[model samples]
Target: MDHKGTIVMQKYELGRLLGQGSFAKVYHARCVETGQSVAIKVVDKAKVRKAGIMDHIEREISVMRRVRHPNVVHLYEVMATKSKIYFVMEYARGGELFRKVEANGRLPEDVGRKYFVQLIDAVEFCHGRGVCHRDLKPENILLDEDGGIKVSDFGLSGVAECRGADGLLHTTCGTPAYVAPEIIGRSGYDGAGVDVWSCGVVLFVLLAGYLPFHDTNVMEMYRKISRGEYRFPSWFSPKLKKLISRMLDPNPSSRISIAKIKGSSWFKAGKEGEPVKVTSDGDEARRLLKMNAFDIISLSDGLDLSKLFETESCLDKGCRIMSRKPVAVIVSRLERGARAAKMRVSKKDGGLIELESRDGVLAIEAEISVVTPVLHLVEVRRRYGEAAEYEKVLNEVIRPRLVDKAPSSLLRHQHSLSPSSGARL
Candidate 1:
């Protein structure tokens, strides 16, 4: 129950607060029906909106939906009311991995390797699905009841759709201590490469009980990171040293890949020697991506079309255009426009289509949803590149092909429709 003494959604019994941030709080909760423990991340909608971080929440949801692995924290479902959004997730009773390391100092080689292998397995699964957890650090990694790894916190994650025309991620966001050197340089960087670099830093911390690049001054630490200036402890085994060296290579191109890391002698020592295979249910994942009635209502501001279509403070975040044409016709027109503009178009599940420029300057994702039998709402959002470039593409390609006119009252009445009533593609 909450402070009001009412169960959350009549489903979860909220417990003590576990953690909090500027806009969100995590609570320990139990299912009223099953008595199963779970973590509920309660996000204040007003605060998030005021901070203009709704995009981060949306991206986190998208990334979590795409990834499912034993070592990754699971998102059971999302719930929202007028004031708050709740993320019901798996509860890791063992708590943050950082706590364990902090209390016990450096872990034994075998123990550290076990956790690292699990971390890599989970990371590999995410990368396979084109999701990169930009912030990979000890605190973000949780531990299950059995002390196994459960990676969490994906607010900074990026997906392949976010790559620019250059086929690289441009955002430089991560903890300074664990940030990749290339990201510090402010040049375009591969998502997977930056993740690998952070993983290397994590490994060093696990074995050495200290950051590889550290200095009293922040600038000095960054210089050390840029130079890849770090030394292994004398106690580190030859194989471990070699593997860490390759992983911490200053050159992103030469940095060890996940597959190569798995094949390394140190990684396979005292173990089964075979790489773990992580697989996901594609059909189920796609199904989960579909917006239910509740989700639609939550995202669309209780079916208020005006609020949904209103210009955002930042135009690069997204925009909605209503179309009178059929879904098939809209898609056809979009593809034609993309081709004419020398952009590549790829269709995805749930009426999502991706457009990427040949010059690698911009990438956008457009999702079409049925607002009514005769009306469709197409949401176009930039995944990468400058707002000006995205706007140019929107004007030259998307707007001409998809925008029919301003949205009508029909959308405002959509609150009465069920998921099966019409609001699906």
Candidate 2:
């Protein structure tokens, strides 16, 4: 939208303005060679420089250049003139996913199952290549006339594989409602784990036509998220609840693995390669996104996660006073030699954690529930910098339960939960 030198698409006739963003404007255009419809995204170099996204824009082009999948959006070609950069992409005939959700109400199980598989397959491909789609939601997923899902909007997408100083990711990026707790806690987290968490949220939205974690007040939502609290209506099946719980685990370490997600009962039960609805005419698979309720708010609007650095969670400091919220815990993990280990230290009581390292890999299930305490207890003390002293209550009342368990048994302790329960802020 902001540019100087003009390179008019004199060959390809430009039509309606499809969309606009901070970086570019997209228009529906017809290719002179084929007379076929295509969407053109024109970006200005000066705007890229002003936003300090020149690197991101290049990374996006490089990433898009390598991706070759039917489920993912295809970039036809790129052209750069002095004033503008061009991205010509295949036009998805169908409309937004959010519009279909709002108009159709809660989709039938079969309908959701079809779309879920498509979305997962797209995500699986990205993960296979060491990429993490930081943003995954209804708005970014497009539908073709045939009801196929086309994953678009790669502006926020980038590789999360840590091959440098820390082998863990700590960027406080992603939409708040769908973000993983490890991200919220400012502890380094596995990129794959956080992506799965977001996918889980998207899955919930597809089936229920509502967000599981919804709050109007920003801080209020943060408080609810901190507590790992969310509610699903009684009418939803128990199986759905189980899946959502695993996806929304308060601890990223505990979130369900993508492998488990693909093999889950919900996904496995659905028909293969089908649309949302199957009719003789095949019109029900995907509803058109044009003029839908979802269009009222462009889904990509909040996707530019660069704004997160403005939060107190900026990575420059060892500890950040996050949004005036009481700093309660410091959670961290180490992965080496096939072992992914985590330790949460009492914030009030600081010292080396004498944790028993697992002989093999960290049990994925335990990582979610148990490791949270390791981080929080230490954070509570670190952020407060207070006189509150921690007591070794576990040894006095809890050591007896270790007799038969793999890890020291915590049932022997008086507290209903292992050290993980009642983790303080």
User: Which candidate leads the pack in lDDT?
Assistant: 1
Per-model TM-score on C-alpha atoms? 0.72, 0.62
**Candidate 2 residues 1-425, lDDT tens each?**
33322324444566678778888898877877678888778787778868877656655654564344578887775555545667778888786776788888777777787887888877877765446777788888888889988888877664532222344666677888877778788877777787788888788887778887779997778777767788886667888788778878887766788789877787777745545543221231122112122111111111111221111221111110111112222122211211222322221111222232233211110011111212111111111111121112122211222112332222122222111121110
For candidate 2, the TM-score is 0.62
lDDT of 1 by residue, 1-425 (tens): 34423478778898888888898889999989999999999888788888877778867865675576789998876766656677889999999988888998988889899999889989988886668999999999999989889999999998766777677889989999999999999999998888898999999999889999999898999999999999899888999989988888889999999999989988887458566553334443454355444433433423332232122344543666767797789989988989988999997643468898898777788877554455556767787778888888898878877765554464466556432222321
The model with the greatest TM-score is 1
User: What is the Cα-based lDDT of residue 69 in candidate 1?
Assistant: 75
- RMSD of each candidate? 6.8, 19.6
List clash counts for every candidate, in order. 2, 20
